[model samples]
Target: MTDTTHNEYTLTCRFSSFDTTVDVIFNNTVDTINDCQKKNYEGFISKQDYLVPEILQQVFEYYKKSYPDYYQGWSYGNQLTKQQIEENLPTPTNAMNLKKFIEPLSVYIADNKNCEEGTFGIYFDCTWDIKSSLGVVIKKWKVAEVGTGDIAFLF
Candidate 1:
């Protein structure tokens, strides 16, 4: 429906259902994504637009369960990992209690398509209490209508 042009990298999208505007990221170099898959992104957006909150909850749950080891790092100080220790970057704890720290930064959608459907991902800046960002693909967001899995599915 909305055939807006998007360049590679980041995009800004508005979800009218909730009056939300979020940045969108894309990696066109993904081999699984073709023109059709790209266009299918629009439909995925529409389908999951209303479930944003639920999707977020699911993202946190998935992170806790799927990557328990990763989530078990730090509660107050830097992590023991070589990179984290060398960088002296303070490790953060699970966002279960630090919900305020979970900042939704963007909505990433591929081009759009017909045959194969491509879903979108919600990228959140969970750095406040996590290692990297917490990216929720329609998969991580996990509504059957959109999908279920990790953020890697988005690209």
Candidate 2:
């Protein structure tokens, strides 16, 4: 059980075997605390509510459906440091083109079918290297993680 109180609202999460129950209390009278609680307790995860990219959310759902035992919770937390991002950036000479840059990678999990309990972590790494017509080179890299419906992007 975890309780968090803020000026705008108060949130309490109760963990259980069936599902997690989240209750919310609003400081303002106009807020519907019960409605908020209902929204939070729903079993399904929503990308719009969490501001997650649809592609990332799809990946999460895929893992959840394919490997229920391995999928614990979805998370969007920063697990990589700036230095790591810089190190993972692609070299200018091997950069991918624009069309290739936005293309999503095929989702890969260490254990596709057999997932253990606790927390399941998914890592995504992307690098873009662009070479201008003049031979100038630019490098970019991004690393992301998904766990328990949470997603984090490291650039």
Candidate 3:
């Protein structure tokens, strides 16, 4: 049997709010146990490393859920209050599912408006390694950029 003892993986997501850009970096070792484990665990762990984007998403969702009138049909130019933003932090389940590791470095941003022109950005950096028994490791990372006049796209 081919030995699959060592695998390493890394994923980096950087979002430029000022420029409205989302950048992703994924690195992994394939066909080897060590590489697979490393990559899988790294990607999973990295999810919890960044909080900005995750928090932003939660805040936006909370706004949509609570004060719908203020945000309805607004655009990217809208501004929100710090209090409102803080109130939007994700629930325990949501946070766990989004990022496997919890740390202080994560940051989130949200435009106060409720229109297509409004923009929400998230940035994530993470790393991990695979285990000996796991097979066919799959790691998926998704970032959704919401903005005014732009349909939501998952990348």
TM-score of each: 0.49, 0.19, 0.20
Residue by residue across 1-155, what tens digits does model 2's lDDT show? 12233333334433231133433222322323344333322321231123223333443343334333221111125465545543533122322222122222111111212222111122223331222110110011112333322232110
Pairs of residues at least 3 apart in sequence or in different chains that clash in candidate 1: 23-107, 36-113, 38-111, 38-112, 39-111, 39-112, 39-113, 40-112, 40-113, 139-149
Q: Pairing residues by index, what is the TM-score of model 2?
A: 0.19
Clashes (backbone N, CA, C under 3 Å), per candidate, total: 10, 14, 42
Sorted by lDDT (best first), the order is 1, 3, 2
Candidate-wise lDDT, in order: 0.49, 0.26, 0.29
For residues 1-155, what per-residue lDDT tens digits would candidate 3 score against the true structure?
12134222222333332222332212123233333333433443455335345554553443335334333323236485545433332222443343332212222221112112112222332111111110111113433432221122111
Error of 1 at 99 (Å): 4.4
Judging by TM-score, tell me the better candidate of 1 and 2: 1
Clash number for model 2?
Answer: 14
TM-score, candidate 3, is: 0.20
lDDT of 1 by residue, 1-155 (tens): 22225334454667554456765555443334456444545554666555656665565565555443543454236546656532322233443443554556666565433133445665666543345566665543354322232363354
